[model samples]
Target: MRSQPWRPQRYATTAVGFLAALLAFILLDAPMVQRLEAPTLDWRFQLRGPIAPGPDVVLILIDEPSLEALGGWPPSRFDLARAVERLAAAEARLIVFDLLFATSSNSDEEGRADAALAAAIAEAGNVTLGYAFTFGPEMLTRLEDSNRPPDGTALQRYRRSPQAISPLPHANGTLLPPRSFSGAAASLGHMSVLLAPDGALRSEATVVAFEGTLYPSLTLQAARQFHRLPRSELTADVGQSISLGDRRLAVDSRMRLPVNFYGPAGSFPSYSLFALLNGAVPEAALRDKAVIVGSTAAAAVPVFVTPYDPALPSVAYTATVLDNLLLGRSLVRPEWLRGLDILAAGLGAALAYGAARRLHPLAVPLALLVPGTLWTALAYLAFVQWHYWLALAVPLSLMALAAGFGALMRSQAEQRRREAVARERQNLSRYFSPAVAERLAAKSEPYSLTGTQSATVVFIDIVGFTGICEALPSERTIELLRGFHSRVERAVFGHGGTLDKYLGDGALAVFGVPDPLPGEAACALAAAAELQTSIAAWSDELVAEGLPRLKTAIGIHHGPVIVGDIGGESRFEFTVLGDSVNVASRLEGLTRQLQVSIIASETTIQRAREQAGTAGGNIPLGFHRHGDVTLRGRETPLSVWVWRPAEESRVATRRAAV
Candidate 1:
């Protein structure tokens, strides 16, 4: 038999799974989750290890040895001018300083030193000087008029688009070199770095907004000069990318590029300023290469943490940015990637929910892990192979939430089903034997109790119930009926028959109802014989107690009948309903005229013989053939058999004589 139709619980469970995923997606931008996600990106970089750097850029550090060679902390401008002249003479493609020359000397001797440095910068014609921007509270007090750079300075030659709104980092005031020094420089750009939330340097702003104009970074200016592109080739598209001739460098919404470091500090070729100035390092080493000069001396410049090194010198950080710009290998985390992350999270959650619903309990964990592991592997491969950053934490959280919630919903639904089964068993006990009811209720899978099947139907009644009731008072009549019902229940249930229901003075029982059993006809025949013996014993007790004796008539028939819970919605009964039932009732009435305690149709007797087979010796041999008689509702006459035990016959004869 088939189970009932689909229910709402399944739909409710699916909806809950999707809802959990949506909640996770909403919290993707929370500060705590984002903080947890940051370390994952760091782990990817560490796992990829290090790569070889290109031979296009080099670092010249003013190390401790160079500082000692120069006599003290502040090197003389004359020495700095000599270093510039040497790099220019070597025909270096670009010379960028990760330093600020914002002040001039007070002594006559040092004044000439500053003038000599300016003349050296002009003669070189390819030096890009570094500057700084003040963003502190002091910037608020400075007048805008005094903050402007000198006219015709290198910073003004760069391109600035009027239509593009300024989305780059804003600068409050400038820290430029003296006018004599700046006027002679070929280019000027800011040397500013912003730290990550964790105090690690990972990205740099390619351009900064200042006084209604855009200023390029030190690395950007060096890239422009190294390529020999005119000022118009360097263009900033705020919140998108930087257009450098035919190539576009991707940037975040804030116009920042994620610095892809080749390795730790000294990843690029390096030399000491002392060696370069003293002619110990060959001049040809600087030929056709862009050079960055910064101080590696203790406390000389700020040191920041990077993915590869905990204390990376600021000069090396600038070199990393320039390397990315020249090679077009910067890490990209564009705004559109966030949309893809959300889609992956949503789909993964839904798939996890479906898997948890159908898979076994032990396999559920594996099901949840599969999607999470696959996404993580894909994200790592993308980062290693293509420098693409994919989100890790948010999508995993979504899958876990959906799977857990789906499991909880399934557990609750199971609990509900168990409760329903318990109630059904309690109801079934009213119309069936305890064993039958328990068997029906304990099924692991769903089943239906309504169907058409062949069974043996038995009807039993008190032969003179009406006359006996009149002779007794109301209370006595109830007691008499209870005694008779108790005996009938024992006889039917003892032989595995269903006690369908009780009539006012009679009861109907059936074999093979709800589910069919083997040898059901024999079981029914045995129940009929047991009822005859039980009622006779009860009648003798009543006679000894000076009350009316009890007598019962039973009829048994074997045929097909429809059995199930049938009636109006308000009240229903599990019973057998067919012509077979009517035939059994009519046969029970015939017992009175036949003067026998039991009268069974020939069909029932033949079925019993067939089912008993070689075990027929166990069956009682007291039945006698009776003449054919037409039942009340049927045109055909049915042959029947009657049985009258000797004890019952003697009891009846004595009553007739009296």
Candidate 2:
């Protein structure tokens, strides 16, 4: 078989597809695609279901009931002090406030209440206070006035060049706890949350560098204080892990950590502040747990947009991150892993192109479906099984585009080829069945002249055709010819034989002409048998209609023959011409002398017998050897065989019995 010619446009489409994938990968961080990623990440949580929250984490929520029972908002600092005292007495491992107390309440007794809250924190000795960072002008001015020199006291020191400072989230100002309140807490951490482009808060700065000093996030500070890690033991490098004693925090270059929420709001066990304050909750419930105290009252604290919930209490984000760090289940997508995404996209595009090119035009979509589905499953598994954010949309888009584009190109090319072949098939259909016409049209070689191949040639003619036609009017004679042609044509095509042409009272049929048949000789014999049966039936019908009976003699021979257009190009006919064809015609004439409806050359008989031996019962007719005789064009004797229908033998047996 000849190879197809190369077309650059086909590959150009594939190239464009691959480039499209690359473009998607590049735009992965764009606002639109990133928004797409958020839900995909959320899908992993949905797929994994809710994982059990860490055993050592709990929330002491200042919820609606707590405020209703306590009879106030912000619950005076003195009231918070009482709650802290209760938790401290309960032997809580660590206490973290997800609240801001940067100023005193504008009341006369506010000073005393602030002093009481400071005393409670100093007495607890394990409390971590939270503060917020703001970029407002007044906050910036406050930070400028209170700007402390770079402190060399922190443990998580970052490696930076003399002039190259560590890149961190910059905040002009912070809403600090009151002086007394800040000094009493064991440590203070910033409660800053970073919202994604879609305004969903899915991550937070692990640590923020401000005013020449680094401040750990509220979650990080809580984890550190709980683990009792010294400042000297904590260390971090830009774009690397922050090690604090036994816990390691994976952060991006900007010191951001993706919040892996365990579930929707209320995933953690919560004890109402009013219950704890009133001794309704037991110390056993608080023992050994890191307690996070925050307001769940909608107006007091803003809700966070998390994967699990859109209006989750802001404190849940802090608690989830703390839980993630404590359990070492952090979700991190290292900078280097994006390369894998690119590689996957490139490989997917290459495979998709090859599959489209190799597969049948109709099967290209099916071929592309396998890879597309497998890649998506793998991406989900990467997130679920391993806490890695494998970029999916970008690479998957590339593969789909490339595969689809390649398939489209291949389809277009095949469509053009089919259109050309369809035109040729129409011409061939005039002389052959549609099946044979398609085969001839599909061949690379032309049907006009210049072909010699092994084939089975058959000649079928009406017995006593001249006398029968002369007795009928010209119109009736033409009708008889039409009926004869239909019967012969049906038999030939029904048995995979090609009807080559009509010859007035006879017709030329060929087996294995346009294309080779597995058993051309057997097929020819079968077609002859079918033609005999059909002629008998038609004769019965004609006799009943008061018309002349019809019979046909068929001759078949298997040998080499010249097959192509025989007439001049101006008016050519696709037909066979050779000694083999002449022999078949002679055998048809001999059918009348032998008193049989069908006769075949010894060559055809041998071929049919061989085919029958390979595939049982390929030849259904009973063949009897006929005496050899010299043909008109040849001096040598040509052996022949006669087909005696089994029905005739059966009828003779019945007559004898009668």
Candidate 3:
């Protein structure tokens, strides 16, 4: 046996799979893969269902009903003023508006309404008004502000060194609340929403850098007020924690916080502005809760996209963020996650490689599914139970791809092995069984005898072949022999019997060679019957073609035989050399004396009957016992049975009785 040379292609498949996983990990933030993360987040929400919002937060919606009652879109400042007054009277802990009052109101009733709203804010003392940061030609063309801080005292008290970090987005221009409203309000926060590349709101910028100053987001400002934290104690460190008294948040380098939405829109308790102004809302619902007032009417306010809802109100988003902070629960993509992703990909690659290399080809598909299913389950568990979002789409896909690649590579290797065996079988077919050639190809050992084994040996010969060859032309005789050989070969291979060798007008077949299989005797008998039927059909075809009709005789014997590769190393042949093979050949010669197409020794008949139960069904051999006779080279006489079809046997039995 010779060893095969090392092939690089063998390891290349696994390497490719692993490298693909690494590539995907490195490009985790790419736009193509980022889109996949959305569905995984959605899966978490769907699996967990809806959770109740934190008890300390409430959403005050200026909904369609409010607009209808106020006579149209954009409720008058008076309506807003009365709503604010109601909240103030209820003694709410903090009130933050998602609505931006960047422009002044009209004269007459509007001016009075604005003044009234401003007075309500002054009275509340905990109210924080929203100021947007817009970027457009209108703002660029206009004269810039004096760069005055809205909350100068608080800004100066909590300001960090300007050179420490610069992660917040620099605004082109600021949208401040009307001076009167700003002066009346206790604090002001920016209401600039950040949208993901896919147009979904997944994170919130807690702070924005503007004109050498940092501004807290609306949610952050409202939360700070609720905690009653002084401006001097608050701190913002980029890529670190944002400390407001005892409530500290671990934010990303961009100072953005991931929002774990409780549910879809309207998950929180909400009361319409009309209901509040009409005294329909209970005072207790507003008391001590972090209330967010904003328009849910799409026509009036910007309709933002969220994981659970596409048309979520901006105010609801702010409320959810506040809820996340107050509850100290938010999805964090830690810095170490990249390393973890790489580890997962590496593990998947290893599993895929192992499966492809060790498992059977038929089992490859099922083996590949294990990693995909396991990772998905782990990802979901991490998100729901641990609050860690592990992106699995890319990692799992890469794993499956690797597994498939490995399977393909293995299949190609197997195919090549088969082709090599097929070429060997073509040559070996001259002196060995196809089954023996296949077994030899599979093993890395020299072919040899495995001692004595019970086998069913068959011999087939064309009757009167010598006379037919002498009478016909050489070409016609060769064609007839070729046709006879083809018919015998099909019968042998079809029944799982091995075509041992061709002997001019005769051929030898053996069963239970290379590997022992159940029903070997029965299979050999079946092949003999097939040979007779096929040759009979071929003889009829020859007669129709104006050629001589021919007949064949087959003999089957089952007993111990010494089977192995015989002859020298330069030219060796595989064959069985024992009394059983000799008996089978002699039985074929006796077929002429008995005038029967098939003759099976008593050994073959008895073995076929004994193994019939394990062979899955009844044996098809129908034979009647023929008297025993001493065969040449045999010390003892052997009993034989003349093979006959079921119908022929019935007719013979009837004739005998008559």
Candidate 4:
């Protein structure tokens, strides 16, 4: 088998596919791609449904009833103090507040209320108070005025290394509680949540920087208090992970942790502050459990969008973080994961291109779909089973784009090939019969129409052509030849014969040269008989028009011949070369001497008879045996058969009567 020739189009198509994928890779960090990709993570969370949170964490919500019982939205500090006192009395392991008390009260009554709350928090000794860091240009002044740094001892206690917290989110101003409250709290952690570009809170900064000091998040502080881990056991390895005792949790370069929610807002065990205050909750329920206290009143606490809940309360969101920390499981997307994402994009593009090349163009999308579906399933499994955050949208996007571009290029290449074939067919039709030209042009691979083959050759010419031209003008003579050639072309092509070339007033046609047919001899005979009758009719019309009458003679022979395109580099002619061609020409010359319209060699007659018998049909015309005769350029006398059209006899009789 011959090796197929190289095609540049295939390489071009593959390059186009890769280029499309490269473009997608470059835009991996674009806001549009990020926005589109965010929902996929949400989908994974929803599909995984809800799981039971660790029993170590619980929520204390200051809900609508609590607000009503306390008389307003922002419950008095006296009421807050009472709630803290109640939790402490129940021996709650830790009380973390997701609230802020940044300013002193203006009235004496409110001032007394503030002092009472601060006293209660100091008494609890295990309470962690939440504060926020203020950002933006407008807050710079407020940040400077209120920049009383927290106790250095407390700050250094959580700081493993300054370099570890350098990359964390920076804040210019602090939203700290009043001095009374800040000094009374056992620990202070920032209550700053990180939102995605689309304003959905899916993660939080585990550590934040302010005034050259690092502060832990409220969730982290709560976890530390619950676990009772030593300060040395809590370590921050920025851009990699955070070690809490023996457990390591992944974090991104910005010291942010992708929060993995156990479920929606109410997944963890929650108790109403109103119930805790009224003694409706059992003391055992609160004992030794880490409690997060915040208001759930719509007007008091801010609502955040989470993966599982569109409007999740801030307290529940904090509880989710603490739950994840206690369980030592959170969605992992470290800085190194970006390298894997890039690899995935490239590999997906290559797969799509290879599939498109092997499959049909119409099925390109389906081919892309298979790998895309598989990858999605695997990514979801990774998320649920391993808590791994694999890039989804970028890889799938690259595959789709690559397949689309590749298919478009392939379609264009096919169109160009078809156009070239159409032009080649038109050119071939000029030399060969329509049927032969079509067969040659239809081949997809390069091929040769040249070979040595058995065939029936036919030759036809106008008699007395030179004399007839002398009596007519040049224009009229040229028109006469065109008419004659047209008639001959019709007869030859109609019978599947290749009209090789025209010889001024004559033409040579052959059957079964390019492709062999079982009835090639019979077909040749049929063509000759038809030509003889048509030429006779044309001569009668010429006579009626007062033009000189015309006559034509035909000869056919069947034999093996060499057929191919033969000539110099500049030009070529597809024609047959063999003794059979010469024999057929000589037989045509004998038509004038024998005074017959058509003549055939004995071999041709025998072949024709055989073909007709095989086809179960009668021969197109009858042949009368003509005795052996010597022909020009032949040493042996060739036996032949001759035929005269009945149309010629009828024309002669009609002319006599006229």
TM-score of each candidate structure, all chains considered together: 0.75, 0.64, 0.65, 0.82
| lDDT by candidate, in order shown | 0.79, 0.78, 0.78, 0.80
599-634: candidate 3 lDDT, tens digit per residue = 999888899888878662235656678979777778
Evaluate candidate 2 by giving its C-alpha RMSD to the native, one decimal: 11.4
The lDDT of model 3 is: 0.78
Residues 463-558, candidate 4, lDDT per residue (tens digit)?
A: 999999998999999989999988998898888788888999999999886888668888888888888788888989999988998989888999
Predicted model with the maximum TM-score: 4
Clash pairs, candidate 3, are none
Give the TM-score comparing model 1 with the true structure, all chains together.
Answer: 0.75
Off by over 4 Å in 4: 1-21, 145-172, 207-215, 228-248, 413-454, 460-488, 500-507, 513-519, 529-554, 561-577, 589-598, 606-628, 641-658
- Model 1 scores worst on lDDT over the 10 consecutive residues at 1-10
Pairs with backbone N, CA or C atoms under 3 Å apart (clashes), candidate 2: 155-231
| Candidates, ranked, TM-score | 4, 1, 3, 2
Runs in model 3 lying further than 4 Å from the true structure:
1-21, 106-109, 136-143, 146-168, 211-213, 232-234, 244-248, 357-363, 430-439, 442-444, 449-658
Clashing pairs in 4: none
Candidate 2: list runs displaced more than 4 Å. Answer: 1-21, 105-108, 136-140, 147-156, 160-168, 209-214, 356-368, 420-439, 444-658
Error of 1 at 47 (Å): 2.4
lDDT of candidate 1 over 108-212, digit per residue (tens): 998999999899889988888888876765575364544566553333334335544454567788887887777888777788776667777788877777766
